[model samples]
Target: MTRCDVDSVVQLQISVSAKRLLRRADGPLRLKQIQEMVIAKLGRAVDHQQLLDVLQTSAKNGVPRFFVDGDMVGLTQRQRPGPRGCKAAGESCPLQPESFEAVATQAQMAQISKATKKLLCSLGGCMPLDDIQDALRVNGWDWKHEQVLHALQKSAKNGVPRYVLDGDMVRLAEGPSCCRRAQKHAATELAAFLQETEFSSCPWNSALSLSSFRGHGEFLQHVVQDERHSDGRPRFEVRKLHGADWIFATESAKLRQQVFEAIQALDAEVQGRPKKLLDESEDMAEISRLGKLMQDWVSGASWLTCLNHTTLVDEVPGIMTRVHLFDGDGIEVRLHMFMDPTETYIHNHRSNFFSYCLSGRYWHKIWGVPDGEAGLDGGHYFVVNRAKDPSFEHPVGKPGHLSVIAAHTHQERGSYYIKAVTPHTVQPQMDGNVATPVLTIYIKDKAPGPDTLVRVANKQELASLQQQQREQQTQDCRLEGRHRLERLRAMHDLTVLTSHSALRKKPRAGVPCKPSRSSPDIAG
Candidate 1:
C-alpha cells in the first residue's frame, strides 16, 4: 500500500511516476492494457486482476491511455469515469454541504430559539413574530415560531442576548459572532448612550460609588438594575449599538453630534471657575449649572447654540486639557479617550499606584480572588467609591513616590490603567498600610519624537453626549462588566486567586488578586 505525502499525491497500491506518464495518451484507455504494458516493458510479473482492483479503488476512471487496437486499458485515474475538465478557482470542491443538523442538537436548537427571541426583543420588538420565524427559516433553523415567542415571553424582564427592548417594541441585540472591532465600538457607543440618556434612580444609585471609578459588584449592579424602575416609572431601554451589548438610547450614532454639542453647551455656561471657589457651598450654583446643561443635552433640548459651539476653559483642577498629537496635516490622533476614568487617579492620594505602558495598551482591571493561590507581595489596588471615598484631600507626601495609608482592606475594586510608554512601572506610592502593592505604571512614551510628559492637549471637551438609554440601561452595562470580569479572571493565568486554607495569618499583599489578562487588547 502506498501512502500520500507532499512528495506525491498518490493513492494506495500504486507506484507510478509523473515523468513516466508523459500525459500517457491524450485520449482515454483501459486499466488492463496499462498493466500488461507495464509487464511487457519492465519484464515484471504484475497480476492483471490485482492491478484491476487497485486501479478501480484508486482512480475515479481507472486511468487514461492509448488504445492498442481497441481492447485495452490505462493506468491513470481517468479510467474510472468522466471528463477531465478543470474547475476554475473558487469552484467548490465536490464535497456535499455539511448538514446543519449534524452540528445542531435538540438543545442547541432550543438555545438558538431562545437567543433569537432575546435578540429580537432587544432590537425594539418591531419585528413581527412571523418575521422572526422567517429569519430562522432562511438560516436553516428547525425551530417553530412558537418556540421563539415562548422564549421572548419567558425572559422579557431580565433580557436575553436577543430581543433587547427599545421602548415597547423588541429588536435584535448584536449577535456574538459580529466583527471584533465593530462590536467593541458598538459596546462603547451603547454604554455611552445609556449613560447620557438614562439616569435611572436605582436605589443602587446611592450605593454606586461613581467617584471611585471602579468599586464593589453589588453597588455597580445596583446602578444598572434600576435603569427602568421596576416600579413602572416609564421604561427607557438600551438600544443596539454597533456591537454585542445594547446601548442606551443616547448612544445612537444619529445623535452623536447632538450629544457633543450638548456637552459644549454645558461647558460654555461655566467650565472654568477655579476649583477652589467652586467648593460645594460656593459652587452649588455652578454644579447645578453643569448638571442642568448636561440635562439639556440628554433631553435633546438645544441644538449647537452660540454657547454650544463655544469651547469652555477647563479650570476644574486635575481635569487637564487632553491635548492632541497633531500629524503633518495637523490631524490629532492621540488624545485622551475619557477624562472621567482618570479623575479618581488625581483625587485619591491613598491609592498607591504606578504603571507605564504605551498609550495604546491601557486596560481596566477588576475581579474577585481566585482559589488556593498566594496574592501578590505588594500594595494591592483599593477600590474607591466616590460615595465612600475619603472626604478630605491629603497633602502630597512626596513628589510621586511614598508608601503610606494603604490600611483599608478594599477588595478588587479596580479600573483600567494602560501603559502609555515602555519600561513602565506601576508601584504604589502611599504612606502607611502595607496590605497590598498598588500597581501604578510609569510610561516612557512611544509616540514619535519625545514630547510626552508636558501634558499639553486639548482639555477634555466639557461636553456630554445625547443620552438615549432608559434609566435601567446604566445598571445593565456596569453589572455586565462585573460578570464579564469573572470570566476574564481565567484569562490572566494567575492561579493563586484565594488562600482560605492557610492557617497562619500573614499580611496578604493583595496585588496578586487583581484582575488582569495574559494578553492585552492592543497587540505587542
Candidate 2:
C-alpha cells in the first residue's frame, strides 16, 4: 500500500480505540490519559499529536463524536446512550438509579423533608410538586419521584404539615406566619440600624451586607418574603422607590412621605390622556380606551406643574390616602394609595368614575342588591351621606344582604368604569412586595345626593365601621396644609425620578437630554 493509504488505516484504528476507551470509562478523561489508554489498546508506537489531531477533527466535524475542553476530552453526550427509563439519549434519568432502593430509608425521608421545607421557604412558600422533585434530584438526592410524593403526603397528615398539596401544587401551610416572622425580624433589625445611624431609611442591599447584621442569608430571606396581614394589607415597611429597595421604620413619617411623593411624581409623568371621550353608553370600552391612552402616553411636559394648582390630600390611616388631583365643572380626579383591603364593606360611589391601576393589583367586586332590602336579611346597611356630611360621621340608613354580580382582579394598566350607585368595593390583592396604589378619574354624571350605600355582612362589621369612623375623625385634624404640600412635593420628586428612569430605558425617539440625577436620598 502507498504511504497515504497507510496513514488513513492508522487514523481509523486510533479513532476506534479512542471511542472504545471513552465508552468504558465513567466520566471525562484528560487528553494525556486518553492518549495513554489508546496507545496501550493499540499496542503500537503512535504519535501523540497524530492521535489528538484525529480526535479534534472528529469533534469539530459533523456529528461530533467527542468533545475537547482545553486538555480534557470526553465523548459527546450524543455519542453515549442514556441509562434505563431515560426518554432521551444522554439525559439524566429522572427515575432513581438501579443502585438506589425502590423505597427510601427513614434517614433519607428525614433528609428529604428538611430539603423540601428549605426549598419551599426559598420559593415564596408555593411551588409545583414536580418542580420540588426536580430540585431535589438536581441537589444530588436520588429519591424516586414516588418516594418524594409519599414523604410529602405523610408529612402533610401530621398535626402541622411543612407543606400542603393542592392538586399538583405544594403550598407551605405556615406561609403567612413565616412571612410575618420575617417581617418582624427585618423591621427590628432595620429599626436598630436606623437608630445607630443618622439616616432614616437605608438602601436595602447596603443594609443586608452590614457586618454588624452578619446574618446575610437570613436578612435576604426576611426582606424578600411577602408579608401581609390577615386582612390583606402589607405588613412590611419595605418600599421599592426609583427601582431600588428601601427598608424604612414603620414610624418613619418623613421617609414614608418621600416614598409616597416619588410614586406620585413617577405616575403623573407616565399617566396618559385619551384622544377623545367615548359616549357614556359604551362605558367599559370608553374606560379601556382611556386607560390605554394613559398607559401609552410618552413623557411630556411635567405633570408636576398641575400639582401647584388646587389640590387636597386626605388620609384614612390603614385604609387609603386620597389626593384630590382636580375638581372643577362637575368633574373630579383623585389619586388613591390603598394600604388595606376594602372588602369589609360593600359600597357604591356618588359619581360614575374611571379607575386605572398604576402599580400592583386589586380584586374589584361588583354587587347586586335589591332596593328597600337595605338593612334586612341579616345584613347591616348604612347610607353614607357624603354630600351632607363629607366627614362620614354618621351613616343614615340600614341596607340588606347583597350578592356579587361580577368580580375581577384589577391589574396594572387596567381600567374600568363604575356607574353612579353601582355597588362595588376594591380589595387589593396580597401578591405584591408593597401596598398597591390606584388612580381614579371621577366624572360627575349626576348631581350629588347620598354619596354611598354601604352594606356589611354582619352587625360586628357595622360596629367596626363605627369604630373606624371615630378614629378617622381624630386623625382628620392631623392632615393639615403643610402635610398636604409635603405630600405633593414628594409626589413631584417621584414623578421626576420615574420620568427620568423611563427616558433612560428608552430615550424618547430622537429627543436627547442629559441623564437626570441619581435618585436622591428620600429622607433628605
Best-performing candidate as measured by TM-score: 2
> Candidate 1 — which residues are off by over 4 angstroms?
1-109, 121-126, 150-524
> How much is 111 displaced in model 1, in angstroms?
2.1
Model 2: CA > 4 A from native: 1-279, 282-302, 316-318, 341-344, 370-400, 474-524
lDDT of 1 by residue, 94-147 (tens): 311121112244565567656564433333223455656666677677564434
Give lDDT: candidate 1, residue 93. 26
lDDT of each: 0.30, 0.56
RMSD of 2: 25.1
